[model samples]
Target: MESDSETHSGEDTTPDDWMDLAVDSPDGSPAASPAATQKPSEEEDFKLSLITWNVDGLDLEKRPERSRGLVKYLNLHNPDVVFLQELVPPYVQFLKEQLVNYLMIEGGRNGCFTGMLLKKSRVKLVESEMVAFPTTKMRRNLLVAQVIVNGQKLCLMTSHFESCKENTAERLKQLHVVKRRLKHAPDDVTIVFGGDTNLRDAEVTKVGLPATVCDVWERLGKQEHCRYTWDTSANNNKTFPFVARCRFDRIYLRPAIKRGIPRLAPDHMALVGLEKLDCGRYTSDHWGIYCTFSAE
Candidate 1:
């Protein structure tokens, strides 16, 4: 658990100004593979990266330039897939136009905004749907998509949750619903689930994902310099507005994908994963995560 000193720093923000992968193998049979239980390779061959961000109240009236910058930043990574929360409809179209190569899809009511973007060059969507929250039921929708990455079948889940500390239970229920929907999915197909979890340690443990799940940030350990993911430079450690942010947005992969191709894929040498994009230049209330993977 982070100490109050850590919590009070305003590293993680909600709403308002606070705000906000991969490779190729080939198409295969629908049958599930034993991929989930496979071990991590001595050396990772494929590279894939993912970013989960909660754009703070994005709309036509809001930060259009920042929004446009975000689209460019995402394009920089050319992420195999991107999960975003707090998306307004117009902003969604804006991103799709800019990310013309991406197959864009979103859900969670018309206003709540949660969606996923897949690079057109890598994957095609086979199916998609939404899971709405209990309280905001129709207000916040969970968007799930099955995509073919590097020729392997994969699942991407994106979402935003009801605000406030008390909504934690409802949020957990939402996560479970997401799991249940994918229960029948082949364990071999890689699963990347993330969005604005709206949770610190207080709520994560309660969700209790199956043993197969792994949060990339936590798995990477706390000693790393870019650990935090929420907040701006004013809130950062003071070097850069985007530096020293907290970890809020995230990318969690199932055992299969993590083992098949576990590497940080980035455009920047500092953000090495896959693709060639610079990350430090762009500033956002939330930072992004990118990891690359390959099929076995």
Candidate 2:
């Protein structure tokens, strides 16, 4: 559990806020070959890939295998940035030992919290900070990081949000804080926020996003295949008796509005961690979201 000293009081705001394992390759497919670095021609555009997931770190059972499963996905996707939720000390430690290629920024020092992993070769870290959710009963906070990726200034944010259907009000408050931060960010920085939001479609509609920001999944046309990220009927990892499906995990992009700063647009989106691990358990109750962006 987190000590009180670790949590900051929430601030009043409108419209703002803000893993690994083991075993075999889940899809029985070979790991993706790394893309060779090439200097982009004038006609070529810079590309960025990101993944966000809730690894269920608090479960404590079969964690090593589950952590290994996460590693496999990281290897497979080789994303430039990763947003993680529900991360505990041991789980974060394992990832640190395994993923030497990433520069990790943790939201909290102890207990379950959120984190960010920036690929060392591609992302140059600028700064990071955490914004506490003032009324959260779950100790939720927003983690934000500023980095330079391929000469583009990018702001990355992540959070677990307030959980459960009953906590909608607090969740929306947290969402507003996130929106304010996004709305206030510098015009030259493109921002990407992702995590286990624990949000329903209706709740998002109630708060509304900023004019410049768009949900990555929706921007990519909201394909049906990747719509439900927390489908109990298919995942079966939580062993809930009743069937339920929801898109609790999501990613949102706010492109830079400044002139001459290349704008990044969503190019592709997919869900990850669909297959069961060698231990016969899925990587998480929620499927991870993988997305690609092209700066044009």
Candidate 3:
């Protein structure tokens, strides 16, 4: 990874300051094949499988052998891309070695690292970056990637915003900064944002994402199975012991075309990683959300 470029300010930086990056496609493959750049035919396959998780700050010092189990758990799901928050640098290095099928890209600071892993053959990483917002004396970031996924250009990002309940304003600030930062991204690609926003749905919308975006869980009619993404009493990687559950973790999307909106597949939540171990510790404090999107 290149040394991350950064700027500190209480106000917006020019669109050019958003840290747009260019990286070779995974394994020296061309960034976009000829077939990939062509106009999509109705027959073109634009399906994407994604997973986003917060490992509760898993790092080498915190849990040295945890990457082994995480690799096993993540591989089982067969995700095309995995977005992770709070995965420290050292553990990321370890997973890069173990999860040979996926390549790692990460960002963030103050121990709130965000990472994204893409299954090498399914997607080509065209660009990757970390957009930071220095607020409340701590820096938060939005980890982003521009990729060619199965012939469709897509921009996917995940974030870990301000955490405490009292820092709602700070969270709102971080939220607005990221929304503005993405305005300069490639205009024609599908965009997907997911991960722990650390804010509830209502609070999230208050930050005002473009009207085109919709929370995938709610857009799919807030199905019964995924009604609650965060819960204290029932989940394995427990946090906020007394905090009642809310849909804190979520996935949001903006379709590629005005009319050809991708339809989300059924069975979006894959909570298997939350299963307990022999010692009764859960795989992670929160369950990962998995969804398949098909370009119509």
TM-score of each model, in listed order: 0.67, 0.87, 0.77
Q: How far is candidate 3 from the true structure (C-alpha RMSD, Å)?
A: 9.5
| TM-score of model 3 (CA atoms) | 0.77
Model 3, 181: alpha-carbon shift in Å? 5.2
Instruction: Rank all candidate structures by their lDDT, best first, as comma-separated numbers.
Output: 2, 3, 1
Best by TM-score: 2
**Any runs in candidate 3 off by more than 4 Å, and if so which?**
1-44, 58-66, 108-110, 181-187, 239-243, 258-269
What C-alpha lDDT values do all the predictions have? 0.55, 0.82, 0.65
Residue range with the least summed lDDT across 10 consecutive positions in model 3: 14-23
lDDT of 2 at 253: 90
Steric clashes per prediction = 28, 21, 1
lDDT of 2 by residue, 196-215 (tens): 99999999999999999999
Better of 1 and 3 by lDDT: 3
Give the range where candidate 2 is weakest over 10 consecutive residues by summed lDDT.
9-18
Top candidate when judged by lDDT against the true structure:
2
Clash pairs for candidate 3: 237-285
Q: What is candidate 2's local distance difference test score?
A: 0.82
2 or 3, greater by lDDT: 2
